[model samples]
Target chain A: MIELEGLTKRYGEKTAVDHLTFTVRPGIVTGFLGPNGAGKSTTMRMILGLDRPTAGDVRIDGRHYDELKDPLTSIGALLEAKGAHPGRSARNHLLCLAQSNGIPDRRVREVLDTVGLTAVARKKAKGFSLGMGQRLGIAAALLGDPRILLFDEPVNGLDPEGILWVRTLMKSLAAEGRTVFVSSHLMSEMALTADHLVVIGQGRLLADTSMADFIARNSRSYVRIRSPQRERLLDVLHQAGITAVESGDGTLEVDGDKAEHIGELAARHQLVLHELSPQQASLEEAFMQLTAESVEYHAHSGTPVSPQQWGDDWKKG
Target chain B: MATVQVVRSEWTKIRSVASTVWTLSLAVVVTIALGMLISALARSEFDRMSTQDRITFDPTFISFAGMSLGQLAMIVFGVLVVSNEYSTGMIRTSLAAVPQRGTFLFAKLAVATVLGLVVSMATSFAAFFLGQAMLGEHRASLGDDGVLRAVIGGGLYMTLIAVFSMGVATMLRSPMLSLGILVPFFFLISSILGYVDATKDVVRFLPDHAGSRIMQVVPPVGDDTPYGPWGGLGIMVLWVLAALVGGYVLLKRRDA
Candidate 1:
């Protein structure tokens, strides 16, 4: 487990991370969610004892990372994709880091094979592509076979197959009772992989809860029904004490009713329904909603349109 | 000890980098080859000169003429060993692995010292043999007066100079800056001091000037400021120690 208490980091007049206190528990994948520049990387570095926290401390498995006699065996991290030396061969790179923490030399080959870089292990890292470099970084992290793992933006440059591989790897790692803390701005990816969520905004802790609980509070769910007699469907929903809004597509968006209940109501009303589908707020929509005002860097492309405006055409039956 | 581990890691790191091997190889080849060329030319020139000018032909310094040029290559080798770490961003990984800043510098110096000794010894030996062969009948055997002394002092002195170069490299992390400062100090300041009578007293104590006294046959032309061969080596050793301490202090006080 990794624990942070009142952790803070400031750069002169700017605060990078502010009073971040959270426990990243074991046996599950905890997603650290934030928009760009929300201090996820800063917090991870603090946890690894790379950056000195301005106010408080972070501990891994009940001890500070540096104080641990062999930290690599307790916590593995890929804080930056380019952390490895470019001149060293991938194998030698792993070997040096392994030796530093008393890890056996055999572990280097194991991690290289595990990451599917065995064929290119002898090649210098300067020749690696972004995805290849990310794999090497992950290989280094797994070299110690530690109980805790931290990855920041692990899937940034991966292909579809590589993305699936990373997602599965993270899930399996958590299933083995390891504490896996992954930071990403891709909420869609995290929603599928992370069992729990810790959302931060502008360097402050905004939410820390199970993924289910987070969605329940921050996301909205409803049913969309389009019928020849849309007005009749609306009337039936209002009479049943269900709030229905007339969507831009001329459909009745019925809230407070499941898709099954809405279908049964339309059947009873003898409405010729063209469409009846359940719609839950996607992780992307929810993320945008939660972090709208707190986004650190706003795109200056003039007139920012809402996500709903962009996705409304696809919402039509 | 963790320091030993760091030293081992540093050894692996420096040796693994291709430039380390290349630089050291160039230093050896350049030293030996240049020593042969200069030795042959010196013998021919000495033979052609009038007998009156032959009094200045002290063969000891002539045999090690390569030291003047070879030291430049060794200095380049020394600077790159440290500066390349900074250029490639490997220093961050190294520092992160071994967070004790002073210990890291010690390990780096230890690696450089061992490498310096090996390269210096190899180059010195090769240069001496080639120089001796080029001198023909002008070459003095090891049994001659102070001949063995010059041979031993030649190799040992070169090693000390290389160590001094490595120390300076550590103090100035930028290889080019160290080279810029080291070359002028060796080729310019010391030579200009040699032409004058007054400043020679202080300038002889400077790193290269005082150290090269070990390789000379006569007592540094005309001066009472001359130290014994071992004493000259001691002066260079002092310079190395002082550079190392200053490097350590800077490392400890600065952020990586």
Candidate 2:
């Protein structure tokens, strides 16, 4: 378990992390979501005691990071893929870290095999691909088999196979009752893997809720309908007290999951319906909606800034 | 965490890198090879030396002349040992493994210092014996007054050079910047200042000048140095201590 209270980090005049308070509990994958420069990396560094917080406290398993006996055995973190020395072999890199925490040498080899890098374990890290380097970092984090694991952008440079492998690994680790905290800007990936989410925007907490609840609250889901007899469909819907808006693509959009009711009304009126589909907003759209205001870098390509119906624009673009 | 575990870990770190082997070997080869060459040269030119030069001729000190060049390699070794962590982005992982900043820094230093001492002592003994062989008749025996102290001091001097470099590297945190300052300061600037009459007094207090006094068996003619051999070494040690303290304080306060 990792607990942060009133955590803040400021660099001179600029505030990097502002009053972040959240608890990452065990038995689930907690996704840390934020836009670029949103302070996810800074917060992780503070939890490991690598960065000194400007104001606040972070604890791992109810004790300060430095006070933990063999801290690696309590919490393991993979902060960056290129953390190993270029000249040192993968085995030796893990060996030194293992030795530091009194972890045995055998465990180093075990982690090597676990990460599927045993064949290249003797090779220097400089020669490894970015995906391979990420595997090595994960091996280091799993060296002590700690109860809590933290990975920052774990699948950044991975192949499709590697991405699936990492997603499955994170889920299995969480299923074993370990607290798995991962940070990424990819909301689609988080929607697939994360059970809970802690989102931030411009260094401030935007939402801390379950994945299902977050999407339900921040996004709009509607039913899209297209018909040959548009006037007849509009009249039946107006009589039934249903309001429908005509989209730019000649489709009528009704708010909420009223597809079944609309479909029954169209059938009763003998309306020839070309299409009837319920459109549920993805986590990506929900994330954009939540962070639209706090996004630091805005693309100047005349993209719509409003969150309400930007999904259509995004799809068209 | 026990200090010994971190120490063991540091030993693994130092030994695993190729830089450790090549740098120390270069120091050994350069120190020994250069000492022998200079000793042979001095032996051939002995007859043409001035009477005053003959009076104050120090055979022990002449053999260790290669140290001026050889110590640069020691500096490189020391700088890389500490700065590699920062350069390769390994410091974050290392700090995460051992969050106690003091223990982490000191444990690495302790391991590197021990290795430096062992290699330096061996190189010192080799250079002394080989240079004496080249000098032939003018060779100073180990049993001679102050000869053994000078020999042992030669090893201590080399090891201290490496340790001092480690301290400075920790503070500077960049191999290029640390080497940029340390290499020229010790190799060119210190020697040039020592030669100039106006700067000679102040230069003596510098780490290298103060530390090298231990290798002199016979003081130079017109020598007016205020400190004894041990006193000079003590001054160098003080400089090392200051650098280490500054490094520790910075490491404690700054984010990794």
Candidate 3:
């Protein structure tokens, strides 16, 4: 269990992390979600006591990080992939860390095998590929078999197979009643792996809720309709006290789960409907809408067109 | 955690890297090989020297002549032992494992210093025997007055040079920047300053100048140095201590 209360970090005139307070509970994979530069890395560093916090407190398993004897057995972290000496072999890198905490040397070989790097364990880290380096980092994190594990951007450079492997590993680790806290900016990835979500935007807490609740609250679900008798369908919808929005592609979108009602109405009027499908907003859209105002860097090319303009242009046509 | 565990861990860290072996071996090989070459050259030119030069000539000191060039390798070893953590982003993982900053830094320094001392002692002893063989008739034996102390001090001087570099590297935190300043300061600037009458007094206080005094078993014919061999070493130790304390203060106060 990792607990943070009123955590804040500032650099010169800029605030990097602001009053972040959240408890990462055990028995689940809690996703720490934020845009780039939203202080996820800074917060993880503070949790590990690598960086001094400007204010507030952070604790792992009811003790300060530094105070914990054999900290690896209490909490293990993979902060970045390049955290080992480039000239040292993978086995030696793990050995040094294990020896520091009085862990047995035999565990080094075990972890190397666990990460599937045993064949290359003797090779220097400077020669490892990005995915191989990441595996070595994960091996380091699992060296002591700690109860709490923290991973930052674990899937940054992984192929699809490697991604699935990590996703399954995280789930299994959580199932074993360990607190698994992983941070990433990929909402679709988090939607698949995270059971709980703690979101931040511009260094402030945006949401702390279950994954189901977050997606349900932030996204819009609607019924989409396309018909050859578009004008007749609009009149029928108006008389039925239903408001439908016309999209640029000539599809009508009603803001509710009214697929059955629309289908019944079309059947009654015998309208020649071409397409009728229910659309629920994806986690990507929900995350974008929630963090749109707080995104630090915005690309100017091909910015999304406003929906109000779509309405105005439709009325003009 | 016990300090012994950290010490063991630091030993593993130092021995696992190729740079540690390469730098220390380079220091040893360069010191011994060059010391023998210089001794042979000095023996050949012995007859051309003035009467006063022959009377005050120190054979033991001549044997360690290669140290002037070899100490740079020691400096490189010292710098890499500490700065590799920063250069490769390993410091974060290291500090996270052992969060007591003082223990982490000191254990690392202690392990490196011990290795430096062992390698340097071997180099010092080997250089003395080989260079004496080259000098033939002018060789100083271990039984001569102050000869053994100077030989032992030669090893200590080399080890101290490496330790001093380690302290500076900790304070600077970049291998490139530390080497950039330290290499020129010791190799070129200190020697140049010692040669000029204007800067000779100040040069005596620099780390290399004061530390090298320990290996001198005989003073020059018109020598006027204020400190004895032990006193000069003491001054160098003071410089090392100050650098270490400064590094510790900065490390404790700053964010990693």
Candidate 4:
């Protein structure tokens, strides 16, 4: 178990991580979600004692990171893919790390095979692609088979198959009763993998809840109804004391899971229903809603200005 | 964790990279080869020298002249050993494996310094013998007074140079920045300062100048240096200690 209590880090006047207190428990994948420039990376660094926390404590198995004997055996981390020296062979890279923690040499080969890099074990890391580099990093993290594992942006450069493989790997690792904490900006990816979520925005905690609960609380689930006798259906819904808002596409959207009630009411009134479906907001929309106020770098969505506008602005300047 | 494990791990790290082999090879080859070339030139030109030049000619010191240039390679080796961790983003992983910063830094330095000592000793011995062979009748043997000490000191000098470079590299944490400052400071600035009468006193305190004094078996004409060979080496050791301590303090205080 990894416990962070009042973990904080600041750079001059800028607070990179602010009072981040969350416990990553065993036997579950805890997704660390945030917008760009959030404190996910900084928080991970502090957990490993790579960055000195401004005012707080992080403990692995109830001991400070530095106090843990052979800390790799307690908590393994893949902070970045380019953690290996480009000139060193993959085998040697893992070998050195293993030796540092008193892990045997055979484990290096085992991790290499586990990551599917055994064929290129002797090759230097400079030749490896982004996906291969990520694999090597994961191999290093798994070298000691620690109870807690941390991966930052693990699937950033992976292909579809590689992404699936990483998802499976993370899930299996957690299933072995290990604490798996992964950080990513990809909400869709987290929805598929993460069992629990600890979300932050602009260095502040926004939500800490289970995957299902988070989406349910932050988003709206509504039932959409379409009928041939739209006027009659509207009257029936109103008479039944249910509010229905007309959608832009000529369908009525009721702000609750009233699909069954609405269907029975329409049938009782001899209303011919064309479509009746309930829509639960996806995790993506929930994340956007939760973080919309705190996103640091916002990209405005619109068409580009025409050349004439650019010319006119230039002339005015 | 035991310090021995970290030491062994650091050994693996140093030997696994091609830079270690290439840099040390360059140091040895350049030192020995250039020493021979200069020794050969000195032998042929002995007849044309003035009386004082011939009187003060120290064959032991002459053979080790190649270190003036060869030590640059040693510097590169030392700098890369420490700074490559930072440059390649490996320091985070390394520190994660062994979270004790002092143990990690010192173990790495110890391993690199031992390797530097071995290569420097081999190069020192080879340069002396081959340089002496080229000098022919002007050769200085191990049996000669102060000759063995000077030869051994030559090895110590090169090793100290590499160690000093490692200390500086640890402080800088960037190979390019470390090399950019170290190479020119040792090669040009120190030399220029030593050449100018106004700055000669300051230059003697510099790490390279004080350390290289160990190679001198006989003083130059009109020699008035305040420190003996051992004293000069002591000064250099102090410089190395200062650099290492500064590096350690900074590394402890800063984020990885």
Candidate with maximal lDDT? 2
Q: DockQ-based ranking, best first?
A: 3, 2, 4, 1
Candidate 2 structure quality by residue, lDDT tens digits, A1-317:
99999999999998899999999999999999998788999999999999999999999889999999888888989985489999999999999999999998999999999999999988999999999999999999999999999999999899999999999999999999999999999899898899999999878888899998987786788999999899989999999999999998889999998999999999999999999999987778878867875553234345536544555667889
Off by over 4 Å in 2: A226-236, A246-251, A263-276, A296-317
lDDT of candidate 1 over B1-256, digit per residue (tens): 2666667677777777777787678777777888888889988987687765566566666778877777777777777777766666566555555656677777777787788787777676667777888988887566766666666777666666666666777677777888898878776777899779798688878877777767666543344766877788788789878987877777665444
CAPRI classification of candidate 1? acceptable
Clashing pairs in 4: none
Residue A208 of model 2: what lDDT? 91
Interface RMSD of each: 2.6, 0.8, 0.9, 0.8
> What do the candidate models score in CA lDDT, each in turn?
0.78, 0.93, 0.91, 0.91
**Candidate that beats the other on TM-score, 3 or 4, i.e. the better one:** 3
Error of 3 at B76 (Å): 0.5
True-contact fraction per candidate equals: 0.20, 0.92, 0.87, 0.89
Task: List, residue by residue over A221-316, the lDDT tens digit for candidate 1.
Answer: 888888888677778878987888887978878664488987887788887889898888777888877777445223324565565654674587
* Candidate 3 CAPRI level: high
**Per-residue alpha-carbon lDDT of candidate 3 for residues A89-130, written as tens digits (9 for 90 to 100):** 999999999999988999999989988999999999999988
Query: TM-score of the candidate numbered 4?
Result: 0.92
lDDT of 3 by residue, B1-256 (tens): 7788899999999999999999999999999999999999999999999999999899999999999988999999999999999899899899888999999988999999999999999999999999999999999998999888888988999999899888888889999999999999999999998999999999998888898898888899778888889899999999989988988888877777
- Model 2's CAPRI class is high
Quote the positional error of residue A90 for candidate 2 in Å: 1.2
